[model samples]
Target: MTMTIGILTENVGVVGRFLACQLGIEYINTQPLINARPFKVAIAGSSHV
Candidate 1:
Protein backbone atom coordinates (compact mmCIF):
# COMPACT_ATOMS: atom_id res chain seq x y z
CA MET A 1 0.00 0.00 0.00
CA THR A 2 1.14 3.53 -0.71
CA MET A 3 0.01 6.89 0.63
CA THR A 4 1.12 10.45 0.33
CA ILE A 5 0.88 13.47 2.61
CA GLY A 6 0.73 17.11 1.75
CA ILE A 7 1.61 19.79 4.25
CA LEU A 8 1.15 23.48 3.54
CA THR A 9 2.51 26.16 5.82
CA GLU A 10 4.42 29.41 5.95
CA ASN A 11 7.40 27.37 7.14
CA VAL A 12 7.45 23.58 7.54
CA GLY A 13 11.10 22.92 8.28
CA VAL A 14 11.09 21.14 11.65
CA VAL A 15 7.45 20.16 12.08
CA GLY A 16 7.06 18.55 8.67
CA ARG A 17 10.28 16.57 8.94
CA PHE A 18 9.42 15.29 12.40
CA LEU A 19 6.00 14.10 11.32
CA ALA A 20 7.43 12.37 8.26
CA CYS A 21 10.07 10.73 10.41
CA GLN A 22 7.62 9.43 13.00
CA LEU A 23 5.26 8.26 10.26
CA GLY A 24 8.09 6.63 8.31
CA ILE A 25 7.28 8.46 5.13
CA GLU A 26 9.07 10.73 2.71
CA TYR A 27 9.12 14.49 3.17
CA ILE A 28 9.12 16.77 0.18
CA ASN A 29 10.47 20.21 0.85
CA THR A 30 9.73 23.37 -1.15
CA GLN A 31 13.14 23.66 -2.75
CA PRO A 32 13.05 20.32 -4.60
CA LEU A 33 9.55 20.91 -5.93
CA ILE A 34 10.50 24.43 -6.95
CA ASN A 35 13.62 23.18 -8.67
CA ALA A 36 11.65 20.54 -10.58
CA ARG A 37 9.33 23.14 -12.03
CA PRO A 38 9.81 25.61 -14.87
CA PHE A 39 11.07 28.89 -13.49
CA LYS A 40 8.45 31.59 -13.40
CA VAL A 41 7.67 34.76 -11.55
CA ALA A 42 5.41 34.51 -8.52
CA ILE A 43 2.94 37.31 -7.87
CA ALA A 44 4.70 37.91 -4.57
CA GLY A 45 8.12 37.39 -6.15
CA SER A 46 10.71 34.86 -5.00
CA SER A 47 14.11 34.71 -3.32
CA HIS A 48 15.18 32.01 -5.81
CA VAL A 49 14.94 34.42 -8.69
Candidate 2:
Protein backbone atom coordinates (compact mmCIF):
# COMPACT_ATOMS: atom_id res chain seq x y z
CA MET A 1 0.00 0.00 0.00
CA THR A 2 1.13 3.47 -0.85
CA MET A 3 0.45 6.61 1.13
CA THR A 4 -0.52 9.86 -0.48
CA ILE A 5 -2.01 13.22 0.36
CA GLY A 6 -4.36 15.47 -1.53
CA ILE A 7 -5.18 19.09 -0.78
CA LEU A 8 -8.60 20.42 -1.75
CA THR A 9 -9.48 24.04 -1.36
CA GLU A 10 -11.90 26.59 -2.75
CA ASN A 11 -9.05 28.86 -3.82
CA VAL A 12 -5.93 27.67 -5.60
CA GLY A 13 -3.00 29.82 -4.72
CA VAL A 14 0.74 29.81 -4.05
CA VAL A 15 0.15 28.44 -0.54
CA GLY A 16 -1.30 25.23 -1.96
CA ARG A 17 1.61 24.79 -4.32
CA PHE A 18 4.10 25.50 -1.57
CA LEU A 19 2.53 22.96 0.74
CA ALA A 20 2.45 20.33 -2.00
CA CYS A 21 6.08 20.94 -2.76
CA GLN A 22 7.11 20.73 0.89
CA LEU A 23 5.10 17.59 1.47
CA GLY A 24 5.84 16.03 -1.94
CA ILE A 25 2.16 15.44 -2.60
CA GLU A 26 -0.53 16.46 -5.06
CA TYR A 27 -2.63 19.59 -4.72
CA ILE A 28 -6.12 19.60 -6.20
CA ASN A 29 -8.15 22.69 -6.84
CA THR A 30 -11.88 22.13 -6.36
CA GLN A 31 -12.94 25.55 -7.52
CA PRO A 32 -13.61 24.45 -11.10
CA LEU A 33 -15.67 21.46 -10.06
CA ILE A 34 -17.62 23.54 -7.56
CA ASN A 35 -18.34 26.09 -10.24
CA ALA A 36 -19.59 23.38 -12.60
CA ARG A 37 -21.77 21.69 -10.01
CA PRO A 38 -23.16 23.69 -7.15
CA PHE A 39 -24.55 21.14 -4.69
CA LYS A 40 -25.02 20.68 -0.98
CA VAL A 41 -22.57 18.42 0.82
CA ALA A 42 -23.60 16.38 3.86
CA ILE A 43 -21.43 14.11 5.92
CA ALA A 44 -22.22 10.40 5.76
CA GLY A 45 -24.77 9.18 8.34
CA SER A 46 -25.38 12.75 9.42
CA SER A 47 -28.57 14.74 9.07
CA HIS A 48 -28.52 17.82 6.92
CA VAL A 49 -28.80 21.03 8.87
Candidate 3:
Protein backbone atom coordinates (compact mmCIF):
# COMPACT_ATOMS: atom_id res chain seq x y z
CA MET A 1 0.00 0.00 0.00
CA THR A 2 3.03 2.33 0.44
CA MET A 3 6.69 2.56 -0.57
CA THR A 4 8.84 4.95 1.40
CA ILE A 5 12.06 5.26 -0.57
CA GLY A 6 13.90 6.91 2.33
CA ILE A 7 16.02 9.12 0.05
CA LEU A 8 15.90 12.91 -0.63
CA THR A 9 18.38 14.10 -3.22
CA GLU A 10 17.21 16.01 -6.29
CA ASN A 11 18.78 13.75 -8.90
CA VAL A 12 18.19 10.60 -6.85
CA GLY A 13 14.66 11.79 -6.14
CA VAL A 14 14.05 12.55 -9.82
CA VAL A 15 15.14 9.06 -10.74
CA GLY A 16 12.98 7.59 -8.00
CA ARG A 17 9.97 9.64 -9.04
CA PHE A 18 10.48 8.79 -12.69
CA LEU A 19 10.73 5.08 -11.94
CA ALA A 20 7.84 5.15 -9.50
CA CYS A 21 5.66 7.18 -11.81
CA GLN A 22 6.35 4.85 -14.71
CA LEU A 23 5.75 1.83 -12.49
CA GLY A 24 2.62 3.41 -11.01
CA ILE A 25 3.86 3.39 -7.41
CA GLU A 26 2.60 5.96 -4.93
CA TYR A 27 5.42 8.10 -3.60
CA ILE A 28 5.61 8.49 0.18
CA ASN A 29 4.90 11.65 2.16
CA THR A 30 7.97 12.29 4.34
CA GLN A 31 10.61 9.89 3.18
CA PRO A 32 13.15 9.77 5.96
CA LEU A 33 16.36 10.82 4.26
CA ILE A 34 19.71 10.38 6.00
CA ASN A 35 22.67 12.70 5.34
CA ALA A 36 20.58 15.05 3.22
CA ARG A 37 22.89 17.76 1.83
CA PRO A 38 24.58 19.16 -1.28
CA PHE A 39 21.55 18.40 -3.43
CA LYS A 40 19.31 20.39 -1.09
CA VAL A 41 16.51 17.91 -1.50
CA ALA A 42 13.17 17.79 0.30
CA ILE A 43 10.52 15.14 0.77
CA ALA A 44 7.01 15.31 -0.64
CA GLY A 45 4.10 16.94 1.23
CA SER A 46 6.69 19.15 2.97
CA SER A 47 8.12 22.59 2.29
CA HIS A 48 11.75 23.08 1.38
CA VAL A 49 13.72 23.86 4.53
Best by lDDT: 3
Which digits, one per residue and each the tens of the lDDT, describe model 3 over residues 1-49?
A: 1234343234446665564565555554245263233223324323222
RMSD of 2: 10.6
- Candidate 1 is scored at a TM of 0.34
lDDT of 3 at 2: 22
Worst 10 residues of 1 by lDDT: 35-44
- Over the stretch 1-49, how does candidate 1's per-residue lDDT look in tens digits? 1222232222355664564455554555567456222221221123223
Tell me the lDDT of candidate 1. 0.38
RMSD to native for every prediction?
Answer: 11.9, 10.6, 9.9
Q: What TM-score fits each model?
A: 0.34, 0.30, 0.34
Query: How does each model score on lDDT?
Result: 0.38, 0.34, 0.41
lDDT string, candidate 2, 3-34, tens digits: 12222222335554454455444444356455
For residue 34, give model 1's deviation from the true position in Å. Answer: 4.9
